[model samples]
Target: MSTTELSLAGSQPGGLGRYNRQAADLHYVTSRVMVYLLAFTAVSVIGFPLFWMVICSFKTSTELYQFPPAFLPHDWTLTNYRDLFIQTNFPIYFVNSLVVAGGATLLSLVVGGLGAYSLSRFKFAGMRTVSMLTLLCYMLPEVLLVIPLYLFVVDLGMADTLISLIIANTAFTLPLTMWFMRSYFNAIPASLEESAMIDGCSRFQAMRKVTLPLALPGLVSVGVFSFNHAWNEFLFALVFTSSETKKVLSLGLATWIGQDNIYSWGMLLAGAVLVTIPVVLFYLLVQRRLVVGLSEGGVKGE
Candidate 1:
C-alpha cells in the first residue's frame, strides 16, 4: 500500500475510537441528569404538603383564609399551637396516642419476634397454612373486624380504655410484624443458634444474644410500622371510645371539622403538624436500619 493511504487508515481508526468514547460519556451524563431530576421531583412531591402544613400552622386564621395563599407566612405566629395546647384538649389526645402506639409497638415486637421464631425454626403439620392465615388476617378490612373486636372489648370490660386501643392496634399490627420478622429469621442460619447452645447458652439466651442482634434491622422496621399505624389509626379509636379524655390525636383532629360551625383551620393545621412530627423523627432515627432491613428481608428469605 502507499504510505499516505496507510497513514490515513491508522488515523481513521483513532478518530472512530474517540467518537465511541464521547458517545459513552454523553450517555452516562444524560442518565445521571435524568436520575437526579426524577429524584428531585419525587422529593418535592412528597415534601411540599408537609412544608405547607408547617407553614400554615404558623399562619394566623385571617392569613390562612386570605386569597392567593402565601407560601411563607408574612406574619408568623404561634397562636394556633398556643390554642391547641390551652384552648383545646390536644395534649390529652397526644398523650393517649403515644400511650396506645407505644404499648402496641412493644406488644407486637415481643409477640411477633417469638411467633416468627417459632414459625421459622419449627416445621409441623399446617405450618404453611398458619403462616398464610396470619397474612390473611392482616389483609382483612378494618371495618369487618371492628364489630367483633368491639364486642370482644366490651365483654372483657376494657371498652373506652386505652388498653382496648392498645390491644386493638396490636391485633392489627402483629401479623405484619410476624410475617416480616419471619423472613429475617429464616435468612439467619439455624447453625448460629445451635453453636450458641453448644457454648452453654440456653435456647432463649441464644436467641437473645445471637438471633435478636442479627435481626435488629427487621425489628426496627416493624416497630416503626406498628407505631406509625397505631398513632394514625382513627376507626378503632372512634368506635371503642366515647369520652373526650380517651380520644387520640386522629379523633381529636376530626372534632375540628364542624358540621354547623366554621372549621378552625389554624389549630387543625397545627395539630396535623404536631401529629406528623413523631413519626418523621422516628423514621429519621431508624432510616438506615429500616432500608437495610426491608432490602435484606425481602431478598434473603424463601
Candidate 2:
C-alpha cells in the first residue's frame, strides 16, 4: 500500500477498540449527568410545595378552596394580599420577629466570638472540660429547658417581652456560635495577635483590628444561623406569651389558621411569601461571606 493510504488506514480504529473507548466515555458522561439530574429533581420535588403555596397566594378565596385546590390559578388577584395587610397584624408580627432575631443574632456574635477566642487561645485548668460541657449544652433540647426558662423570665418580669425570647434563643444559639467561631479562629495564627501586642495593641485591640477582619465571614455565618433560629422559633413564643400583640410571625401564622376558615389559604400563603423576603435578602447579602469563611475555616492550630 502507498504510505499515505497506510497512514489513513492506521488512523481508523478497529470496531471493538472504538466501541470500547466510546462506551467508556459515554458511561462517564452519563454518570455525571445522572448525578446532576437527580440532584435537580430532588430539589424541585422538595421545592414544589413552597412554589405551589406562593402561586396560590395570588388566587381568590373561592379559587383556593374549590374541590382539589387549583395548582395554578386561572384568576390571579391582589385581593388576598390586600386583605392580609388590612385585616391582620402581619406588619407588627414582622417587626417583632425582626427585633427579636436581630437582637439574638447580634448578642450571639459578641458573646460567642469572645468565648470562642478565649477557648481557642487561653489554656487554663478545666478549659477542655468547660468546652465539652458547652458542647453538651448545644445538644440540650429547648423543650427540656422550657419550664425553668419560663419561670426565670417571669421572675425577671420579661415573660411576654421580645427581650425574653431574644435571651432564651441566645442561650441555646451561643454554644453553636462559639464552636464555629472557634474553629474559624483556630485556623488563624497566634502570632498575628502577638505581633499586634508588640506594636502596643491591647488584646482587645488586636482581636478587633487583625483577627476580627479575617474572622468576619465566620461571624456572618454565625449571625445568619442564629437569626434563622430566633425568627422561626415557635415553641417558646407559643408557651411564654399570651398576648396577641406580643406574638411573632411564627405564632401569628398559627393564629390565622382556624378550623372554620380553611379558605384563607390565599391569605396564609401571601403571609408566608412575604415572610420569606427578608430571609432571602439576608442570605443573598451574606452568601459571599459564607463562601469565603467556610473555604478557609479548616487548618491546624499553631
Q: Per-residue lDDT tens digits of candidate 1, residues 213-265?
A: 99887788889988998998999999999899999999888877872145578
Give the lowest summed-lDDT range of ten residues in model 2. Answer: 293-302
Clash number by candidate, in order: 0, 0
TM-score of each: 0.84, 0.85
- Residue pairs in clash, model 2: none
Lowest lDDT 10-residue stretch of candidate 1: 293-302
Which ranges in model 1 have alpha carbons more than 4 Å from their true place?
A: 1-42, 258-263, 292-302
Q: Per-residue alpha-carbon lDDT of model 2 for 137-163, expressed as tens digits?
A: 877888899889999998988878888
